[model samples]
Target: MAAEIRTFTCLTDNFGYLIHDPATKATASVDAPEAGPIIRALEREGWTLTDILITHHHGDHVGGVAELKQRYGCRVVAPHDKSTKIANVDLRVVNADVIKVGSLLARVVETPGHTLDHVSYVFDAEKVVFAADTLFSIGCGRVFEGNYPMMWDSLLKLRALPDDFRLYCGHEYTASNVKFALTVEPDNPALKARAEEVARLRAENKPTVPTLLGDEKKANVFLRADEPSVAARLHMKGADPAQIFGELRERKNKS
Candidate 1:
């Protein structure tokens, strides 16, 4: 029942994860933005990659698939919709598909806001979710191929997860996200406190990921779009929650 989650930085602000289960000596790599760094992480961890769990077809998310598969001979599991782009995809799974890695079971959640094919892997046993780009520490992914309402629906699915679930997103943009969040929810006390904390963490050169779901519910504008406080701050009365979330997301992009 032993497990470890390792985070690696890649390509400016992208994050890649290496998840290992010690009970069966099995490992899974999530959204490897690059091959070399993931390889280095695997070697340093003394874990052999048994599977590669991809969330989408974006280059940053699937760029290392070809090389890693050739090198580790690991099964590449990705969303069924993007099988064409993922190299040597051995298992094409859809929403709710459950895959096993040692004692850990990963349940696939179809979170298609960042992209129509985007997915999130939920490790239910550990109460954590590899949220790719759909959900971030203080922000959410840009609506690349989806609309405001659609993205809102996608986020709603994630909001139901346990409040304690640790969310490991696909990028390192917490510091920047907090800045924009302040502009949108300037009066939010929780957001103000979080912005200060993020500043300190960045100043110290520390990681700001693996943020809890509860904190996001309080500080992330996307999650708070429905709160009267958030809607009031946006200067729109009785605004559609999804529209508010989308506007906040747009602001973050240009932040």
Candidate 2:
């Protein structure tokens, strides 16, 4: 059976996602941004938390793990690098690890950019990915712990996924990301249209996430560094894609 996904705002712009598989009555929280919202979400849905999946050790992502574990006895799964720092981690995973949440399965893909230990989860059967901070709607995470080359390779791993996959990132930064993206590729029709749509959504206080990978491939400047048009627009035509990506990341940092 297909998983049922519920997304809600947590701690300002962070998003918390709950995936439930009715077949096995298994429920998983993608990230515990905070305890109140997650606990409330579980109560409202009448679903018991069977698992808590951590994308990284960022406080905003794992801050509520202890509380949730105490409340639901949920098993905590996190990346191996910083698993020790995250409280109550029952399973430490690495790249290519497959985790089972009852009848649902998620494939872990280590993506080191925002943090060297960051990982994204992909549910192949559902064509959905919990990308956390690695890849966003119109932007990618800042290269804090890793270099541009590392971030670029990590992004390529995600960009290579099936175009139809749906991406659920860590934050609601699409409005700002689109603004920065326009500065990089102003003449891109797809981006311009998406910006307008994002503006409309934000105007109505709507969430602008769970964006389609196909749409991102066309509009996200960070993901388009390998495209000739994006490179040419930056006056870096014929430059290596990784170099273009590095320059873009540098510019975004100052933006």
Candidate 3:
């Protein structure tokens, strides 16, 4: 059976994920944004957290790690880079590493851009990816520690995943991402439709996540830098995809 995932809001806009394997009754939290909510969620589900996975060392992502580890005695798994600065990591993982969560498996994919040590976990059997801050529903993370080319490459790595794969990102930024994406491809019908859908979801206080990769390919301007329509809209028909992606990132930063 596939792992069951539960998502809850953490902090201001961050999201915390709890993934449980029913067969083995093992559970894991993707990031520890806050301890109170995550502890409450685990208690509500009657699941004991066996592992805590860290994508990067950002404070919001690891703020509650120590507390959660103390409370649940969970193993901490994080990136292998020395620069990450995360504490109490029992296991250090790099690109292509496979992590075992009971009977389920999560393959790590290095997705640097948001941070040089950023990594995403792909559960092939479940067709789901916990992308953290690297790839959001309609927008990618800012190039805070890496360059535009690095960010573009990271997005492409995610874009190359199976179209049926569902993406679970770190934040609830879809509504704003939709608005910014429109400035790059205003005439894109798919984007326009997605904007409407996002608006409706937000109005109802619903999550707009676990979105299909196929939908993102159609509507996310950041991932469509190579598309003719996007290129034409940016007036860079023959420009390299990375260059177009850089310009779009810059525009989004200003927006």
| lDDT-sorted candidate list, best first | 2, 3, 1
Off by over 4 Å in 1: 82-84
Query: What clash count goes with each model?
Result: 0, 0, 0
Ranking by TM-score: 3, 2, 1
Off by over 4 Å in 2: none
C-alpha-based local distance difference test score of model 1: 0.87
The C-alpha TM-scores of every prediction are 0.96, 0.98, 0.98
lDDT of 1 by residue, 103-161 (tens): 78999999987888889999988989998888888888989887888888888888889
Q: What is the lDDT of residue 213 in candidate 2?
A: 96
Q: What RMSD does each model have against the real structure?
A: 1.3, 1.0, 0.8
Which scores better on TM-score, 1 or 2? 2
Residue-wise lDDT of candidate 2 within 1-255, one digit each (tens)? 789999999999999999999999999999899999998998999999999999999999999999999999999999998534789999999999999998999999999988989999999999999999999999999988988889999999999999999999999999999989999899899999999999999999989988889999999999989999888888999999989999998998899
Report the lDDT of model 2 for residue 83: 35
Reference-based lDDT, residue 246, model 2: 94
Q: Which ten residues in a row have the lowest lDDT in candidate 1?
A: 79-88
Q: lDDT for model 2, on a 0 to 1 scale?
A: 0.93
lDDT of 2 at 89: 90
